[model samples]
Target: MSHAIAADQREHRRLQLAPTIIRADIEQDGKSREGYLINVSLGGAFLSIADPPAKDTTTTDLHMLLPWGIGECHVQARTVWEQTDDQERAIGAGISFIDLSEDASNQLQSYLDRFKELSIEITS
Candidate 1:
């Protein structure tokens, strides 16, 4: 599906997030899972990861290293949706931000703006 349509469906702003994959350790179970993030809005983020919190687990906490070398941001997120393959392996997940720092939010917005500019350049 096109990014725009997917974003629209999810009620998220469509932006080309230059994702940086990272290993995430959740506070709940102390389980280490790979998480993908680039630009995240208040609504949700499109994450490409191998393992994710199950549908039963509604909430998670993460220490994410965002762009701008601003250090890790302690983030609280809620799992909105998750999709897996027949192998029962997670392929992607959508997480809604429950809480975020002001600096982190600003950095995310900047990343989104840059992604938009890059997309426009490519399409035009």
Candidate 2:
């Protein structure tokens, strides 16, 4: 199954990053699980983990360190979708930011914009 979102359906363009290890603390149902951020956009992100929350899970709290010495960003997210490998192992999930403070949003956008500019320079 393809995980690609249709271009017309996406609200924002996703920025693929180099393999950067960003540790994340995901909270749900009064429990917390560790994961890593894979890719991100202004709207959402893909999180990789050994055990993902149930599909029925609606919301989660995520705390993760931003790259480039940007410090940490926190937001409440809604589980939009999930993916599993053939072995039934949990691979990752797509989470949309449901609640983000203005400061946090600005911080994230700045990081993404910097990354975008760097990518353009590298490609050119």
Candidate 3:
């Protein structure tokens, strides 16, 4: 399926963040490892990891290091899907937000809104 179609079918829209290294802390199986946020939305984010865990877990704790002074935002997420490379190696994971606090939700929404506004201005 095309990217646009998938996005349309999703519960919450995703924003393809600019090429910036946004660090993330993915904690699973009582361990914490570093990852990168590939895309983000109100629901969850797609993460890029160099070395993903061999064992797949249902849920994880993610801490996003937002830029522009947005700082770190924490959320509980579940691994809903995965993306593999041509060799059938898991390169990225697609997650769904489980429990989102009101403050974190607001902060994420505001950050996304700013980017959306910028994109609109650039296009128009």
Candidate 4:
């Protein structure tokens, strides 16, 4: 298959997560709480949180903290999957980042560099 076709079948950058636990701050209903990042793709991310809203929670402000710094991206998220953690904490959320600002997107990309390096190290 062509490279493009293979790439299309995969998510952006095929990011190889490093199992690094990253924190996410999600706010809704006039309240905010912390969540842990499961993994990330170029256009979206999965998070573990308690009692996340239903699917298609559109036009919500999501704050993602990367190693470089904190990034604020507007997102339209949906509840793709949900499950309780070992601690019996409700977790699991999928978010489709949308209309991200150029700068914000750039920051996210830069942060993913760490994952790339980790992937290289493992492969080698």
Candidate 5:
């Protein structure tokens, strides 16, 4: 596949996830907590954290469940943006993956492909 397609396949888009479907144990700045993964791609994932969003430029270790029973993926990532509620209360954050492995990339791609197919099926 071309490099561009790889990047697009893992683009950080939003997807509403069922609770406990993909659990994420987030470790950052020496603190450890847990969050549910809202959406995930090769590039990054948007995590719906119950705790307050971390500070800017935070590097996080994301341990999560991949789609379609592909298995769990543990990758390092950095916070790029944040999502807040109407009251500006800290809600969730969008993270960009730092370095990903080839195996992990393929697994993520497969997971994404499954989602794409499911979306089409739902629409059709």
Candidate 6:
């Protein structure tokens, strides 16, 4: 298979998460905004907030709360894109993880794995 096809299939294989309330603290340029996580995959996550940073805003410090009694995880990410509503209000932004500590990566992978397992069980 071609590389493009494989990449597309990998994107499609990401688990679709429900609207779980995961807290997120995003910091950029010495400013911080608290928000809720919308969805997540191993590559990236969508964060819902009242005021997203500028489109070109790249690096950010992200602190996220894990579900199922798991503790928090901190990682650095780059903002890939931003979204807004019809009213021009800031809705959310998509961020790709760029820097993750070994522990944080393991924690996030564990959480994602559990979520995937639960999802499969529900569908089955």
RMSD values, in order shown: 5.7, 4.3, 4.9, 5.4, 6.1, 3.9
lDDT of 6 by residue, 1-124 (tens): 8999789557735745443557888888998889877667656677778777666566888898898877889988776678877476548887677767888878887887788788889899
TM-score computed on alpha carbons, candidate 3: 0.73
Residues 54-94 of candidate 3: C-alpha lDDT, one tens digit per residue: 43456788888776677789988876667767476538777
Residue range 7-122, candidate 4, lDDT tens digits:
74476446544455677777776777777766676566667776766676665456765764444543445454456555665377666667767777677767677677767898
**Which candidate comes out best when scored by lDDT?**
6
TM-score of 2: 0.77
Point to the candidate with the largest TM-score. Answer: 2
| Candidate 2 wrong stretches, greater than 4 Å | 1-8, 13-21, 87-90
Ranking by TM-score: 2, 6, 3, 5, 4, 1
Q: What's the CA error at residue 50 for candidate 4, in Å?
A: 1.3
Clashing pairs in 6: none
Question: What lDDT score belongs to each candidate, Candidate 1 first?
Answer: 0.62, 0.75, 0.72, 0.64, 0.70, 0.76
Q: TM-score for every candidate vs. truth?
A: 0.61, 0.77, 0.73, 0.67, 0.70, 0.76
TM-score-best of 5 and 6: 6
Q: For candidate 1, what is the total of clashing residue pairs? A: 0
Candidate 3: segments with Cα more than 4 A from true spot: 1-9, 13-21, 53-56, 86-90
lDDT of 6: 0.76
Compare candidates 1 and 3 on lDDT and give the better one.
Answer: 3
Cα lDDT tens digits, model 1, 54-110, are: 663656776666555545666677776777774764476677776667876776666
State the lDDT of candidate 5 residue by residue for 8-105, as single tens digits: 55543443222223678888878899987656666766777875455466568878777577998888877667777747654888777777888777
- Scored against the true structure, residue 80 in model 4 reaches a CA lDDT of 46
The better candidate by TM-score, 2 or 4, is: 2
Model 5 alpha-carbon drift over 4 Å, by segment: 1-21, 52-55, 84-90
Clash tally for model 5? 0
Candidate 2 Cα deviation (angstroms), residue 55:
2.7
Error of 5 at 54 (Å): 3.1
